[model samples]
Target chain A: MRATFMYGAGDVRVEEVPDPTIVQPTDALVRITLACVCGSDLHPYHSMPTGEEGTPMGHEFIGLVEELGSEVTGLKVGDLVISPFAFSDNTCEFCREGFHTACKHGGWYGAGGVGGAQAEMIRVPQASGTLVPIPGDVDEKLLPSLLALSDVYLTGYHAAHMGNVGPGKTVTVIGDGAVGLSAVLASKQMGADKIILMGRHVDRTGLGRRFGATDVVAERGDEGIAKVLELTGGEGSHVVLEAVGHMPAYEQAYGVVRPGGVISRVGVPQYEDAPVGFGSLFGKNVTLNGGPAPVRAYIEAAIPQVLSGEIDPGRVFDSETTLDDVAEAYRLMDSRTALKVLVRP
Target chain B: MRATFMYGAGDVRVEEVPDPTIVQPTDALVRITLACVCGSDLHPYHSMPTGEEGTPMGHEFIGLVEELGSEVTGLKVGDLVISPFAFSDNTCEFCREGFHTACKHGGWYGAGGVGGAQAEMIRVPQASGTLVPIPGDVDEKLLPSLLALSDVYLTGYHAAHMGNVGPGKTVTVIGDGAVGLSAVLASKQMGADKIILMGRHVDRTGLGRRFGATDVVAERGDEGIAKVLELTGGEGSHVVLEAVGHMPAYEQAYGVVRPGGVISRVGVPQYEDAPVGFGSLFGKNVTLNGGPAPVRAYIEAAIPQVLSGEIDPGRVFDSETTLDDVAEAYRLMDSRTALKVLVRP
Candidate 1:
């Protein structure tokens, strides 16, 4: 089997690796049909590694189950499914509370030293909880969007849900990548009255509009907040979805939400210390909520929408590359030329 | 009129001042029937004034409406009412959102150069919105508890509300002062299954138990959190109400709430910059909420309970003195000789 590994920053390679096998009664093995590079991958790709540990390179994927442990229920061999970014038992207290991403025994598929998804096959623990079976056979063309349901779509959905974006809400989405575009779609589905996408790319902005962004603000930071505030009649957006996992975007998200409104950021802060304003946040009574999306919880609803042609998040895949070209995919995504680069094995 | 003024730290004097008169169309003159010392009062009483201005001494009170401004409605002269610590026009966006304390035109009665409730006659702006009329003259015995509803009761209620305390939930209230004791009562009314009061005093602990505290832990900091976890079977409390405004108490509240639980605090942080652990907070998915209690919102329900004798929070008042003994009242409260002190003119 071949898998993608990061030798160091800006160095990604697909090489032969040991095949995955069920090591626990709760584990299942799946043959990967599709995988994609994530924006979060760029964080380490642009920075120094903590130590000399081999790091896996992908998390989001949809594949066919090849084998399952005897303990696994509700799933079997020859089944197509989507695995959420984080694996959990789904029966823990956190799982019951709808924070499966924070499941007590849950761990990230790739970032936690586990094998990455951009491989010929992958091992999924707690299979009954981590994998959601597809209703029917999914084609290769539907792979990008289905793979998206694994993380990006769920993250975007979480952003909208946490922000309480619904009917009559004016939502603002910061970051014009796959997650932001998915957020625009999710916000519309949640019945947001208006959605303004903040991005510099015309193509991405166009896709945002198609995905239900009623307006677009090309500026960043203070300028972007100014435009959003202006659009909202000086009140600012009622809900803000921050998909960019950086300090500037987080600050902008905080700045543009109306007092008493909500700011939901799915952006994974790169730094250990994320600076939050206690004074301003407390004074305005804003609700800040977001983290790893409970993708498994959202897959049931989002998959139906995608299969019904009600939403086509596949448009977010601006480019596609083979597993051998996984390194190029990383470069294209890091350069911001591609919102998301679908990887085919 | 005579008023209590804090000239500097440890310097409080009862001095003669002109009687307050209506200064704005929304202002009403209130003759203080009962004014009490607050925990926040100690901030200026023991430290330099925040601004270079005359320091008025109190904000909590039950008063008689002596005069109404031309624009005042829903209030009449001779009406006995409880005035919230902060005044706000109920029509503003913030007020409409049930955050009257953050209203655009809101004014703090005692802190920002406005006359304090400790004075014989105080001018209250936004009178109709800030004053809740009490039913026909209450007995003198119940005046202290009713006066507490003006600020302490509502503030404590806000904490419990922020924590989402309700049926089948367990709540831990930090601090055993008047506000913390009131929080126990509020949690019980909210139907919280269990209430734990953490403090180091026997007198207030007894009062808290009487006010519906299910358990008492006289430990401090980590030990207090450890006891709370022990009480909740190592899962931590479902809600934590931080009634004491300090870093240690805030940290303890954070430590004692289970993941996905809420931490509602009404203690105003005296420091300009308070650092919080975004790492632990974000990971736990805790809902941190709080601010000044929207007393006007709760007074409608709270006042009736106070009037009916279903709950007597007035037992928290261990000392009652005349206006001439205001200095001594402060002394007793500062020395922890009284849970709360009520001053009469």
Candidate 2:
């Protein structure tokens, strides 16, 4: 089975690996149908410490259940399914609260010795809880969008949900990456009156506009904040979504969120410390809430919209490739040549 | 007029100062009926950068309007009122959203040229917005409790409100100070099934119990977290209220909050930065929301309970003194000899 692996920084390869088998009573073997390179993947592709052995890559995929363990319930062999980026027991207190990412027995794909999603076949633990079954055979055209539900779309939805983006809200979305564009779609779906996308790129901002961004600010840093404030009648937006995980993005979010507003981040943060001090947030009465998206929890709520064609988040995939060309997918995404790259297995 | 002034670290004096008078059309001269030394005041009392000019102290008070400026509305001379720690215009976008502390035209007492509450008279700016009028003459016995609403009680309520403490939830309140004790009362009022008060002082914890702390964890830091986790059946509390505004208290809060739970802090955070990295909160899906309490917003909702004797938050005042002995009040509170001190003019 061909799988994607990262040997070191800037080095991605597709190599033949052994097919995954169910090792636990709660596990299932899933045959990958579609996988993609994510914005987060670029973190390691740009600069992750190299090891003697290559690390498995990719955490998002839509697949078919090739085999199910005896304990796996609510699923059958050959059923199309969406696997959340992380595997959870779903019965834990966190999972019950729709925070599957924090499930007591959960772990992320490609971490803790788990099989990666960019592969021919992968073993999924806690299958009953981690896998959301897709009804009927999925159309080839809808694969990329459905596969998005495995992570990015749900993550963007989580950002909007946490930021409290709703009817009549002025929402500012930072980053023009796939997740940011998805957040634009989500803010629109949530009924935000005005959606502002802050990005310097022309192409991505154009797509952001198509995804429901009412305005776009090409300025960065202080200028971006000034632009957002100007667009919001000098009061700043009611909600700010941070889809870029860095100090600058978060600082911009903190600056552009109106007093008493919220800033939600779905981007995996790169910094360790945030200055949530008296000078930054206290006087503003802002609420900061967002971590990993509860992708499993949002799958059901988001799937109908995708299936009904209310939104087409798959447009984020600007390029497509075969399993053997997984390295090209990573290269294209790494260099910003592709907004997102879909890989067929 | 006599007012409490901090000449240096640990040096408090009730000195003769010019009586406050209206300086703005929106100002009102308030004759304080009761003023209390706050836990936050101790921050500067312990050590503040001293100069030739003494710093006026005090931010909590219930008073009678002695004089109303020409522009003052909704308030009349001789009317008793509760003043939030900070004064706001109450018409700004932030105040409209119930965040008066963050009002664009507001500023904290004793900072930014605002009059201190411990004085015989205070010139309150934005009087119509800053003062919540007492319907009738407040009894002398009820003065302390009503004054509690000015800061501590409202602050505790803000913590509980931000933490989303409600029916059937387990609540853990850090600190045994007036605010923490108030949080216990607030949590009970909000219908929390179990309220845990984490404090070391038996006397304060006794007051916490009287205020409705179902459990008391006397341990601090890691042990305190362990005790809270143990009390919640190893799942941690659903809501952790941080009433202590220091690093350890925040760390303990982040430690004991259940996954997907909230940690609401109204402690006037002392630290400049907090580690909100993946290692701290990202994987847990926790939410952090809190700031200076919008006391003006909560006064209406909370005063009814205090007036009806449903809760006695003023019981936190374990000592009383005249304005002349303001230094003694600070001394007693500084050495932990008093839980709280009520000052009368």
Report the lDDT of model 1 for residue B115: 88
For model 1 the local lDDT of residue A304 reads 80
What value does the interface RMSD of model 1 take?
Answer: 3.1
Candidate 2 is graded, for docking, as: medium
lDDT of 1 at B199: 88
Instruction: Give the lowest summed-lDDT range of ten residues in model 1 chain B.
Output: B269-278
For all the predictions, what are the DockQ values? 0.42, 0.77
Off by over 4 Å in 2: none
- Model 1 per-residue lDDT tens digits across residues A304-325: 8888778778888889999999
Pull out the clashing pairs in model 2. none
User: Candidate 1 local accuracy as lDDT?
Assistant: 0.83
Q: What is the lDDT of residue B58 in candidate 2?
A: 96
Clashing pairs in 1: none
What would the TM-scores of all predictions be? 0.94, 0.98
A1-345 per-residue lDDT for model 2 (tens digits): 888888888888888888887789999999998999889999999897877788898899988899999999999998999999889999987888888888889998997778688888889999999999988766778888899898888899999998888998999999999999999999999999999999988999999999899999999889999999999998988999999999999899989988888888888889978978787766576788799999898898878888888889888999999888888898898788999999888
